[model samples]
Target: MTPAPSLAELEADCWQQLATALEQKQNRTESHGFQTMTVATCTHLGADARTVVLRQVDADRKYVWFHTDARAEKVIQLEAFPNAVLLLWDPAQQIQLRLTIEPRLHTDDHVADDHWQKLWVGGRKQYLSAHTPGSVQPAPYPGFPPELGENLPSPEESEAGRPNFAVIECRVLAVDYLRLSRAGQTRARFEYEPNERFNWLAP
Candidate 1:
């Protein structure tokens, strides 16, 4: 029988999985693990959850990044609360990760500019909406200009979205990992702030 992995090993594996997911953009199954995550933020009413695409992952720095419209409700919520949770699930691997993060928003700054330069036209189009996010409309809006449908804008045209593009940098504080398997199950928590804390939890 294979010996169970140590807490440290399990923790390392968790980070490795995230790093792999970030780099494997062509592998849909692996990429989906990092490509989409549910972000939960606090609001006056309570918690708000939304699906967001993962833009970058820095395993060494223990940070994750996502792009959003600066004027979005979630951006406002993060500005007010700053602390949020990112939930990622990989159905193929039967692994789930809950990450606590301190969010820092970058807008109208060099950080945002740098990220904006890396965005392709398809990505830039998301911020090109004439209406702000969550605004009530008399008619349904396609999010972007109707003329741009199914066609990527030129580099110069895509620049129109720069003002609305914002990057949310998440400084990871803790990660709870759960893996389900027929052989057995594994659960662990890795905490980075206050001190490095790592432990295996009962599955």
Candidate 2:
């Protein structure tokens, strides 16, 4: 295997890539960008993966965040295994970010509450559904209760789901960045094995 980059180089490159990826709001809603990340987790039997939105990225801290319904099956999987991975590919930029992370679920913490408050009324509507996430019910259901008077529930009606809405904080342990370009492709990995130490991977 090729030698990893020096500690300083690894840290600099990882932060630079992350800052560029998250700073581009254009990618947030783009077809294939930060929003379209594959979240990999472990279940009782083995590993599992699914697409999830990327809610936040803190380059300085080398961490990322995402949201999920506490009732989702993935939450159960996460509870079983705190280790997870996030895979993001930006077709527009021909770049991919593979992040190995340690996840912590924020349910009732002040952090989760802050995120919930910022959610729009329409976005908050998602958690107001009658049935739990991934539930099998007779006939199809829209998830939310049929009636909400005329508008989305005030924070009170939505408050019940606050505990149900969870924010997943992913502390990045390592990140592998692969970019495909006309001038040959480039690949590199950054490893922060120690909570405080960082190392680089050869391209």
Candidate 3:
């Protein structure tokens, strides 16, 4: 039988997986492991959960970044309550990671500008929506203008989205990792806030 991985090894492996996911291109299905994560935020009504694309991850700094329209409801929620949770699951690996984060918004700043410049026409197209996210439309809106349809905009044309593009920089306060197996399950927590804490948890 294969021996169980040590806590240290498991921790390293988890970060490696995240790093790999960040480097994967949009065409790579494996990227979904990290590309699509559930983000939970607090609002006046209650807790809101939504799936967001993971744009970047920094294991060393314990930070992650995602983009959104500045007018999105989640953006407002984050502004009111900067604390949020990011949940990522990889079915192939039978691994799950829950991240506690403090998000900072960057819209009309150099940080937003830098990220905007890196986005291709396809990536920028989503920001060109005429209506705010979650708004009621007269008939139906395909998020972006229907005229654009599947066609990618030119580099110059994509610039119109710059004003709507916003980046959320999440400072990871803690990470809870879990892996399942027929033999047994492994769980660990890594905290990096007021004081660093690391330990294995009962599975």
Poorest 10 consecutive residues by lDDT, candidate 2: 23-32
Which ranges in model 1 have alpha carbons more than 4 Å from their true place? 26-30
Worst 10 residues of 1 by lDDT: 26-35
Clashing pairs in 1: none
Error of 2 at 110 (Å): 0.3
Task: Give all TM-scores, in the order shown.
Answer: 0.94, 0.80, 0.94
Candidate 2 lDDT, 67-137, residue by residue in tens = 88888899889888888899988777787889999999898889898889877666777787767887888
Off by over 4 Å in 3: 26-32
Instruction: Residues 1-203, candidate 3: write the lDDT tens digits.
Output: 88877777777787788878877744465554766789999999889999988888788898999999999999999999989999999888889999999999999999999999888899999999989999998898888889999999899989998999999999999889988999788899988897888899998
Candidate 1: lDDT of 199? 88
lDDT of model 3, residue 99: 93
